[model samples]
Target: MAGPEVTVVIPTVGRPSLAAALAAIGPGPEVIVVDDRRDARTPLPVPDGVRVLATGGRGPAAARNAGWRAATTPWVVFLDDDVVPAPGWAGALARDLGGLPGHVAGSQGRIRVPLPPGRPPTDEERNTAGLATARWATADMAYRRRALEAVGGFDERFPRAYREDSDLALRVRRAGFTLVRGERVTVHPVRDDGFWASLRRQRGNADDALMRRLHGPGWRAASGAPPGRLSRHVLTTLCGLFAAALTAMGAHRRRAGRAAARIAGLAWLALTAEFAWARIAPGPRTPGEILRMAVTSVLIPPAACAYRLGAEVALRTGGAR
Candidate 1:
């Protein structure tokens, strides 16, 4: 069979990085850019050959779908606005897909965050580039047009920017199509700078719960990957809180108040040490960044867990509205 025509679909929210993304693509490929914002505030001038679509404030999933639907190509490659493909990325993608079997539905590429030395990633940066491993990132993922159509494209229920790619990938896999990782690479530059802004973005935890409700409890370890040390931190915090409360109550009953206090104190120290170490070892930092890390580290676990739990409950109960 002849190689499929490739249509590169990029969903953008008017980020300046879109230009870099466009410049990275080599010639001889159809390009589609979906502007999700839809605002009449003057669209950026795309390169002469690229087709642009405006979705008028719909989410990325919708933008992607629009781009794909508009594509005449048999294969649709999705790239995020912030991603810049490396040299030969398009050629590598063509070669990779050409080599895949008929059952292969999609391909993922490696994503790297080109961070400067001596600075730990900000919370927002971590959120954006944390998935740098060789896997599925919307920034560098491509899908067979037929396969995407078979799975009904991306689910619009994933309102905000999270887990929509995984949802689609899981669906494609369940439909008896294989999603293989490709040799092509892209750089996901970390653009978010504010600390608290990143924390507020944890609203995606609600979407995680939605994914779990749709896919089941195993979705966390399966689609979303493991919860990591954040789970452990939550447990430690609860244990310490329980011990402290018990110790205060036991003072009237002459229970082992001293032992309980010591345990609680040890737990607090352990938590702080874990937080400091997680932040410090990445690289050298000024006292301000270190201090910010320390504060955010202590707050991140509980905030994340709370969001996750709430999202899970809401999604399971169908109360996301």
Candidate 2:
């Protein structure tokens, strides 16, 4: 019996790794590359026979919707541009989908993130490695086209490449379809996004707020996401804000303000130190790594809280996108 027809849909921001991803896919099934770069003045160079669609930088969720919607096959596989499929992965994927029942809406490919052999992995490397066990990661996920249509595809409200996959998977499962692990594997390489990468990632906290609002506060448990330090972050942020406010108020009521400031300042210091140490303890203890952790830890709390608060406010005001 013939395997189900599959089309690989890759949403890209013109990363250099996109070419490698396409090459690793090796030209069997129909491939659609969604060009999601904000600037479309320069044409993306893709190999012959690979179709390209433009989303004008609406983000991964929108780009994916564009790619899968354009596909005519029964199966639409979504692959992140930074991943490399294992050799002969096309055949493995076919076999994975061949005997699946109609109720099986999706098949997830195992992801491997290669860390350095010598010495402990850095914080960034360890974070990247988490994708290996991330539930329903789109790094290499395949969904039956009909299931996608039934659920109305990905929610474009998820503007970034975070939480969108989990949200979709939860929705698909709730719609009465099952998802399973597949035999095929893909490699997700660790990226060097510079020193402030961790700080920048706090933007996802806003998306998390949206997840809670849409799927309820139990969304994390329902979606298999880890119980994150959001409560701790909120506490840290409160401490920081109280310390600053008390310090500023010291001009009028010197004695009372000084005592309040001292208490809040100590709480903020302890929280920040603890957060930094948690990250530093697990990885390489190089001075540079320590400094990055210390600095980002101080900022991440406030940044995360601000994002979540902003998203909540947006949701309340009908301004969330």
Candidate 3:
């Protein structure tokens, strides 16, 4: 049987990075860009010969589904607007797809984040490119159109950027198909943002909770996600604080008060050290970056836990799919 024709689908928030992505594709492959932004805000001009579809501000998951549905080809490669394919990417993809077994439903490419020399990755850079190994982002992945149809495309319940790709990949795997890693590579350019800006952008925790509800408590770690050390840190910090407060109120009971205060102080220091070292030891940073890390470190634990808890609760309560 002949291999199916490939169509490239990109979902963009109208970032300037789209131009780089467009320039990377080979000639004659049908490329569709789903514009998720409500207004024309991207500074990059649309390349000629590429089709642009407006999604009326729907999220990436929805935009991806729409884009795939509009594609006439048998295979669709989902590329993020922020990603640029490497040289010969299309040929590599075509060759890979042609040799795929019947049970293989999708393929994911390697994503390399181009960071400045001598600079450690910022939290934002790490988050944007998903520095963790073992899981593939939709930015450089391709899916079989038939498989997508069978699984009903991406789960729209994943409102934010996180977990949606994993969720889809999980479902696809469960349907008795293999998702292979391909030789096709893409460069995910690191975006420049302040420490606080990156922290504020983590609205995906809610979607993560939803994923847990849909999959299970083991979903995070099972899906190649890092351990929820942040959750543990937050819990420990809260316990320490409570112990200290109780001890302060019971100053008349000197023995217990002293013990409680000691425990609380120890816990607080431990959490602080862990947070600071994680950011600092990765690489050399400017004084400003170090200060930002120190300040943001205190806030990340609670913020992350809260988002995870909220997401799990909402999913259990049937708030989102």
Candidate 4:
């Protein structure tokens, strides 16, 4: 079949890599680049023949909605600006979509994350590598336009790109369309991030809570997601807080309270140390890496718990469900 049956939609935030991504796509499909950059001061520039749409700084879900909504193709393929399509990926994608069955609503392209050379991958690298096994991420995914429309496209409630794709995939599946993996490959290089990057990522715990509220508690099992460590986090955080309270109460010379506080404090320290060591063992073991892992591990459980609690309140009170 002559190509162009699939329209490529890329939602970008003015990343410099966008040009390379477009270049690697190699001329076969109608390409639309949706600029989601909130900075209205400067516009994203694109090459000739590639259409550009501005979403006025909305998140990617909105940018993607605009992209696909403007497209007039049977299949709308989404690619992240940070990824580069492998050689001949366009031809492979054309075939990937064209060969799909009626019941197949979306096809995910295979993703390869190149790790840093000469060291066991740090926790960040390991996390980035998990994208390869992700069931459905839009780094390179093509969906039947009709299926997208039927599910009302990506949910804008998920402001961050973290869970938005998974939310859409879940809804698409619930609408009775199965998603399949495709042969097309894309390279999603791990970008450098701040020391607190992983720590800040705990904000996604709230997204997980929203997912549970919208899809029910069984959503994880239904979606094939592994059981997470939320329960352990909750226990760790509570133990830490309890230990602190007991220590404070015993400050006034109460012997019994002091003994209890000592026991609880030891338990908290043991859990924190064990969590930190697990992250440290697989790391590069540099001083900075060790410090980051130890500090973040101590902080993550409480932060995650707090986010989950906040999400429960927000979702239950009609916030972002």
Q: What lDDT does the true structure give each of the candidates?
A: 0.78, 0.92, 0.78, 0.88
Model number with the top lDDT: 2
Q: Candidate 1, overall lDDT? A: 0.78
Could you estimate the TM-score for every candidate? 0.82, 0.97, 0.88, 0.95
- Candidate 2 residue lDDT tens string, 1-321: 148899999999999999999999874689999999999789888999999999999999999999999999999999999999999899899999998999999999999999988778888999899999888899999999999999999999999999999999999999999999999989999987999999999999999988988899899988888888889998988988898887676632687777778888899899999999999998889999999999999999999988999988989999544
Q: Per-residue lDDT of 231-299 in model 3, one digit per residue for the tens?
A: 665665686567668766875278866777777777877877777777777745778778877887777
**Alpha-carbon RMSD, candidate 4:** 1.6
Model 1 per-residue lDDT tens digits across residues 33-108: 9988858479676899888888888899899999999988878999998889999887887877886788998988
| Strongest candidate by TM-score | 2
| Model 4: per-residue Cα lDDT over 1-321, one tens digit each | 354388999999998999889999987899999988877568667888999988877888999999999999999999999999999998899888876788999999999999999998888888888888887898999999999999999988777877889889999999999999989999999875879888889898988998887888898877666678889888889888988897676652677777777777788888889889988998899999999998899999999999899889988788553
Would you give me the overall lDDT of model 3?
0.78
Clashing pairs in 2: none
For model 1 the TM-score comes to 0.82
- Sort every candidate by TM-score, greatest first: 2, 4, 3, 1
